[model samples]
Target: MLLSDLSLSRRLERAERDSNARFVEARAAVSPDVGAGWIDVGGTYAMFDGVESPCTQTFGFGLFTAPSSGDLDTIERFYAQRSAPVFHEVSPIADPAHLELLASRGYRPIEFTSVLYRSLDGDLAIAAPADSVARPFQGRVRIVDADEVERWAQTSAAGWSDVPGVGPFLVDLMRVAAVRPDARLFLAEIGGRAVAAGALTIDDGVALLAGASTIPDARHRGAQLALLSARLAYASQHGCDLAMMGALPGSGSQRNAERNGFRIAYTRTKWQLSAGTRA
Candidate 1:
């Protein structure tokens, strides 16, 4: 019931479950260290950053309910009571009536995110363009720990430096993710210094490539490709049937993913709740 053709239903199932798992794992990530938690509002999962620090999705919801199900009022009350930045990811396969309902209820489109996926039947090679500008490093990547978590976080922050006020959040998320049983943080190191990083979460026969970043100093030397290859290998070994990731449409990230054999599953919208609108 998700995509126009039933041929994609299984893939959509993977994507939906992968997306749902994030909120669940994120809620668990904040449980012991921070008091924040996740709440299921009429089948939708909501996450709140527990420590309340400026870093981190700190608070938001995903895996939205169908508008035809008549849960609009419940969803509205859930966000109306939260008092934090409310966000929703509406998939391209989502019911247009549902989107209409959300828009009618004051949700405004803010951003576009493309979900890409690739089957994990092995054979994922790093994207190495002959005209690559960055220097090829003599370093290797591995699962990280110790001070490496901090380094991974710093690299991620640098990768996303263009975003204002994202450093702290990336740091906290990486720190927490490093300890999650479902999560694995991978780092590419050259000369014993962590340069590029990516995060993977495995659950229910699928792995989500949650985040990938490299510092400006290590942009082009195939760091992300390395991360992707490694993560895919690990996921396949760990029984992950499919691997998925999200990126900005028309961005370099999207191009990189496509070059690595990831197919476009869909483009989704991140909708924000407009001010002064009643549920």
Candidate 2:
């Protein structure tokens, strides 16, 4: 469905849920240094934990999976650690009561984002590169070897200001991509210089479009479009039916997703709790 055709609220809700599920699954599978816990209150469940990153640590509560208020105190104590945690909350859990409770306990909202999704069941037509641009680079992009994987990481770091741990994170992503041949990375280049990069991962019928970025000098040069087109084409060739991405709050990434035929699926909030405070 076209992003412009959906209701903002409906789109936000859908996007957020899909994004949260993807996070829970991906992080749980690959993150070995972090801790994960699920609180079950009758039939309902809430998953909360601390995810460690280099610059900032994240404490997330998957509202849909969260147990009950009666278990909140216990869960809180369990997650309180030495490091200051950034709390994350998604929609449906951002009710007034929950907000107030967070505020009363010193939790503050930091960032918000609208999730986006695209259907891959039908043909996706992307405009061809201009005559001046290289056509060989336009075809299905894939990271088939270790050298390309390292290059992808380096290009990603260069695009994102060399954020701490990014290199390691991309390396980890490549580790997964290596075993899964169906997973691929796309780079947009001109005259043999890599200007943009993105990746497509197909898992359990879901195609996640991730790590899309363009170097500062390459912005507005159609690099994003080229990377995205390559990813969609690769996905289509591999039988993926849906494309998903988690966009940061109020960023150009969100706008770009909209322009690329992605509709807002939902909004997700991040919650932080100390690991040491749980008792």
Candidate 3:
């Protein structure tokens, strides 16, 4: 019975912030030529993976500490120097003045994410998929061994192959993620063939679930549910008190999170600097 108050928001946001920062650190360690980097500003983490990498952004802004104008200036400069757009995933529980300041500086809301959480007070019962097609999932989930990093990354990228673009980028990104020290990569296999993948990162007693993907041929076969159950169990065994994730509002991911006992803690907005503002 955890309350969705500011304290909870801080824990959830910090868990995710630390996870993203770890990816940045891992990327830098694995490929320093890519210029992967991150900095902490007034309790906020500003990361720069690439000009177009989704990892390029800020987190925990105005949450741990009220962000001042000078703080914003430094964060903006950090990204500008890297030729990346400034983006901030802002939680609703953050200082209200933060939004006003962002808007005043020409930052516009570009995306929204429903942050969800569920307590891990005891052994979590694995929830069956809602649809009959995915019930009694016939797959098994297991953590990847050190030698299987490439296979894990390939399985993760295969899940996104249908997209018109971004396949190669995802392959590289997942490869880096597979080696992230803070992350545990899980693979769902049916008949001994990997079909799905997901990642879990625990920080300060909170587990952040992310990188969920199922190959096109593997959908509706219960792979995701198997992965979810495995990840949750792993988190609980690791002494995490809660698990959190984010999904687009009204999306199937959100529905799945809800079906698995997660509740919306807040809807966070991702603000991006307008082109004019950047100029």
Candidate 4:
């Protein structure tokens, strides 16, 4: 990662933060339990959705910013106040002071995800599997409709079966994305069946590519690449300078994203609050 792209790096971090906040806020519109308003924990922004189904990392805590060491106890109390875990991400661009404070308070690293980006200066290659040479998913990346929200949520949930009970949250989030300014929800389909879903969130000319998911039967096909190509084209057409996404580093998902032109900017670490610090 180039140090000169600090602006891009920070935006990428905020892209993750702001989009998720939007989801939590948007989700509240469709379901009371899914989206609660956001709050700031010390210096970090906290998204509250009230659901205990999955990790609260995405919805509750902002990355790259940490509470002051003096406020560490207070933040822990805040999470404890809600009976929520003190989960948040620490990225390369985050304030070093934050990580130091987290470490002192017994936070343990739990997850790692690579932040990737590519300039949208030109057209992207739509790479598909050879056996599926018919290119069935091409021209199938359409903007999602409100009625298709459930389908989008279903595909996302099934795509990540390891994380149970997240379908409703994902669906409600997309429902809000459909109407938000500069936010676009997309899906790829064949024969009227939705095969994949992705979201484009543009901020200050940088488009954040998120919520990419494909069903089990649709795996190994170019559904994702097709969605990528469509989103890239759409973002570029709308004057976004670059596009960004995240994936687990060294995982096949990272390789796929790299093949599609995204390069790692940095990998952020998700830290879990140790039980000892609950209150």
Best of the candidates, TM-score: 3
Ranking by TM-score: 3, 4, 1, 2
Misplaced by over 4 Å in model 2 are 1-63, 70-78, 81-86, 93-106, 127-140, 162-183, 274-279
Question: What's the true lDDT of residue 53 in model 3?
Answer: 91
Mind giving the per-residue lDDT tens digits that candidate 2 earns over 1-279?
Answer: 444332433333433334334444444466645544344333223344344532232223333343335545544543454233544454533334666665555556666767677887766855433433434343334443545766775666567755665656655544433333444667777767887777766764457777677778866666777778778877777776777777885677777677667777667566555343333
Backbone clashes per model, in order? 4, 34, 0, 0
Every candidate's lDDT: 0.65, 0.55, 0.91, 0.69
Better TM-score candidate (1, 4): 4
How many clashing pairs in candidate 3? 0
- Alpha-carbon shift of residue 233 in model 1 (angstroms): 0.9
Tens digits of lDDT, candidate 3, 1-279: 788899999999998998999999999999999799999999899999988899999999999999788889999899888888899999999999998899888999999999999998865776664664546778689999999999999999999999979799999999999898888999999999999999999999999998899999888888888889999989998999899999999998999889888999999999999986853
* lDDT, model 1: 0.65
lDDT of 3: 0.91
Query: For all the candidates, what are their Cα RMSDs to the real structure?
Result: 4.1, 5.9, 1.3, 3.5
The deviation in Å at residue 139 for candidate 2 is 9.0
User: Which order, best to worst by lDDT?
Assistant: 3, 4, 1, 2
- Give the alpha carbon lDDT tens digit for every residue of 51-142 in model 1: 24322121123234445434546555644565555566656565567677677778788888787877888576666654576444468979
Worst 10 residues of 4 by lDDT: 53-62
Residue runs of model 1 more than 4 Å from their true location after superposition = 1-35, 50-65, 68-70, 130-137, 146-148, 162-164
